[model samples]
Target: MGSITVSGVGKAYKFYSSRWARLAEWLSPFHKRRHTLKWVLQDINVSIGQGESVGVLGVNGAGKSTLLKMITGTTQPTTGSISINGRMAALLELGMGFHPDFTGRQNVFMAGQLLGYQAGEIAELMPEIEAFAEIGDYIDQPVRVYSSGMQVRLAFSVATMKKPDILIVDEALSVGDAYFQAKCFQRINNFRQNGTTLLLVSHSPGDVVKHCDRAILLKGGRVAMDSSSREVTNRYLDELFGKPDEAPADAEASIPTDSAAAHGLSQHDDVFHSRPGYHPSEHRWGHGGASIIDFLVSTPDASYPSRIESNTQTEFYFTVRFDSDFDQVVPGFLLKTLEGIFLYGTNSYLSSRGTAHHSAQAGSVQTYRFSMPMALNEGHYLVSFGISSGDPRQDLVPLDRRYDSVLIHVGRDVQFWGIADLRATYQQLNA
Candidate 1:
């Protein structure tokens, strides 16, 4: 089987004092002295099974690249061993190992040879590579003239042409436009279905959780956690926000209504309210000082649970309580698909009426309401809301934030397709 085994692996580089010191270290084999070394990875042990997809996640300087470099043979580990049982292809840094003077065609041929393909083998794959790249006649031009996106296209096409037993995709995909990114993901999904062991390194938790079955979190040159993708991403986020506890038990509970509307939602609990299995604790983060006491989605017709048809008007109400005074308060909401792709969002700072910069005393409450048409197709969506202090368009700081706090389901007629319903019209024109 095509599998990878990394045992007690670590990588270190010599820390030379200066250019002359580096020269001295290089020539020191005759002098019996070595330069000081600093470790970037340490004691990393993991075994990836055949056909498994694993995500390597970490912040910058977390040794993720160092680990992948060792596995791909670009560099050697300072200690321990790495074992691979099959052919592999890697898309590491942008434009890595490509000659600036070489044309795209020449670079493809050279890369194929480096990956152990014969001239005839590369010739047989050229057509497919060209078709996938879609860079047109620029394929015959020097790679130095290519844009970042074009380079990624050619590099990705070359890396995936042979469908090697192992595939390693780094953050190169992040440079592509949205369309190319989608295409790359489709190809990766195809490889996964066809039993190619895949290793994906990315900073986006949504991408990791969507594509990988398991993940490893790295921090300070060591493995921080190894678990299912969702759990590992949760741990990673906790590290980013520096919070230890999950969202409060009543995070999804709406703000308490006064005597006027307190009983408004009692009758429709089974229909409009959040479905079972969705809780705020699943995805929520922010700083303290202000708390979102209640957040709810409702229809314009005054329905409490926010049950609505696609293309209908809806309203989102957020009630925030302040623990301290602030110079500016900005409230915002995000609409995301179940897969965590952000489809739409808006903040008070960008409203047409103009930005609102307001201050409040401690223990005061503010309620902000937004009215809009829901043009989404039939799907389950998550609502994320936040209250921030400072210019949201600038260096905004969150006072309180909750992600995936409310789950809403939209029902649509048979005509709509895809994410948004544009209410499009078509006419036949003939001569």
Candidate 2:
């Protein structure tokens, strides 16, 4: 049996003039009504079977949240019907059912009841919930007195403790420390093992890979793609970081014959794809003496590869064309996460055991190729490459620094986080 079913769902909101205009209409009594309806979602059809894990992927303001809210029955769709089987729990937003003035413990009971748990049932699970929250005495304090992380802990515990047949999580995992996040993942894994259906919405590709079997990509309030987690994530990233001015190949052709409407449609398409992802050259760097002319990520066939698989080897090709040559030039590169966490770096001078010097004539193209292990956890990463030379301890001359040389996508496989996946083995103990 299906856990959730949404058929031909559509949602729209009415836009009206300001209060002053409404008051003027009230006074005039005969003023014609001026109102516009904005459609946020249209013809969204999807179904989730029992024990299935599905992910919703989209850029900001793509109506992902709206869809989830509709499915959870928090918001009604303008058209279409939704049927959900069994009890449902949703952690749509942090502190969603929480009162700022109420103690965390009190809110736990309220949220639990809202999730269909009886007060006696919640009391029985309170210990596990408290242990999971790990907030100690603060649990008795007002929610407003708790930190963001603490609030997340409390909400996550309460939502998960009820063990609903359907669980809808919307980016609730982004907060919290690493340890608690890992705990949350463990809980989610347990849920999967127990045949609980999960509907997840997250920007983190890694999470999608780990938790979701299938994913749906929403673009412009419509279902764009429905496929495996990896495929959906790739398409979402492509659209997210795609060039703003470049419309999809079919966009122009798909527009209607009306010139004005076609132009408006083109503009709308551009606006949707313009949402930022990991774009090279978007990185800001310190002033440098030299500039990176070009950098690229390519495959063995010299074709530029957009998406990458985990535990795979790839070649990074970069070229630094100098405007002017200087003595004792050191060229190097660093790979960083989209959030600016440095993953790995290497420099010619550092690896060469001595000063790697190169004198470039003006407008000279110097090429460097590195075959690095792709041990990245699946997500978007930035490649920054530049050249510098002088004293290691003192000031150095930076020739060129490119913030985003390339975007690397590391996908998830049966492996762990690290710079390299050695394909480790293990054995289980039996008691």
Candidate 3:
């Protein structure tokens, strides 16, 4: 009963440099073009049949969301058309179709009406929606106060309140907490099991691999690759890693081989500050007992880079000099988003599982190295390094701390929504 067909669809936006230009264009009798068209999508064609599951892959600004908006009839295509053979339901942008001032329950009725449900029909589904959303009293409160996670919970609950012939879900589901996302996906899987045609967008290739049988990847506003989920994901990953355009900001600048000697020297040069990933506004503090003087972050293919491709093995190294006896010291690091959201972090003490005790002697030098696969989604992240000493029971004394010290850009295929990239593959053992 469910099928979708998109024919030669393209979307373009007109840009005007100033209000005067727009006014002149509107006032002109000839209607001469004063604005240039910015094509977000071009000449797209796809046919998804009943009971089929597909994944849409794309980088940021690649018009993935726009394509979904068109298919869901939220916006008109500048050119071409989309057709759905049966009833369709979609979860697009987070909290879309929801009013910030409206209560979750109120929005449910309104959104359900827009989804083609009658008032009595929506009322019958209210209890099911509220139970699924599980936001307690907040369900009766204004949506504006709901956290991003809560909004997605309510949105997902409403979108999937009833089975439809076709269902489309996007990365907005990733906004929910891990536990709730699992619950949401379970419902999606249940819908798909009931012969619902599904189209999903995920930044994590593993998700596409696991959830979808066919996949399409968009590049520069065009369908660059379309094939089995495995094949398209492989191509997407390859294109991401080999990108010459993803170079660090320091690509245009270089340090001479002898420049280290020219400037200062072994007497102590600020090597960390010279690297391409170094952030100028890094906050530094802590006592003078120990100081972090140098650092290097590298992969097998590159070192001290401004950009690191996702899913590559990365190693972090930082040199700390103990000018005074720093007892029971433990080293640590943090990888956080620009907004200071903690993505991942670990200290040597935690790494050792509280079994190891460490102390630094005066005039001693220590370098800490941590290695892992950088599975972060495409974005800029800040890296911080710190060291401290104290018993595990309570407080600790900070020896040296660097906050938001290094800025790194990650280039990756969109799969899982945020930070950590999961590697998932699928094989049909039988059938």
Q: lDDT of all the models against the reference?
A: 0.78, 0.74, 0.81
**Order of quality (lDDT):** 3, 1, 2
Model 3 residue pairs with clashes = 203-414, 203-415, 203-416, 204-415, 204-416
- TM-score per prediction, in order, is 0.63, 0.79, 0.62
Model 2 reaches what TM-score against the true structure?
0.79
Maximum-TM-score candidate:
2
For model 1, where is the 10-residue window of minimal lDDT?
263-272
Q: Can you write out model 2's per-residue Cα lDDT over 226-301, one digit (the tens) per residue?
A: 9999788767767765633354443333212323222222211213112223353565464554555444354443
Candidate 1 lDDT, tens digit per residue, 1-431?
A: 66999999989888766778867766776864556779999999999999999999988899999899999998999998999999899999997878989999999999989989999998999999999989999999999999999999999999988888999999999999878988998998998899999999997666787789999999999999999987887677555433234433333344434421342322212221243223445455677777776644556453333235778777777667788988788888888998999998888867645646667668877777666788987556888878888866679888888788776656554434379888889999998
Residue 351 error for model 3, in Å? 14
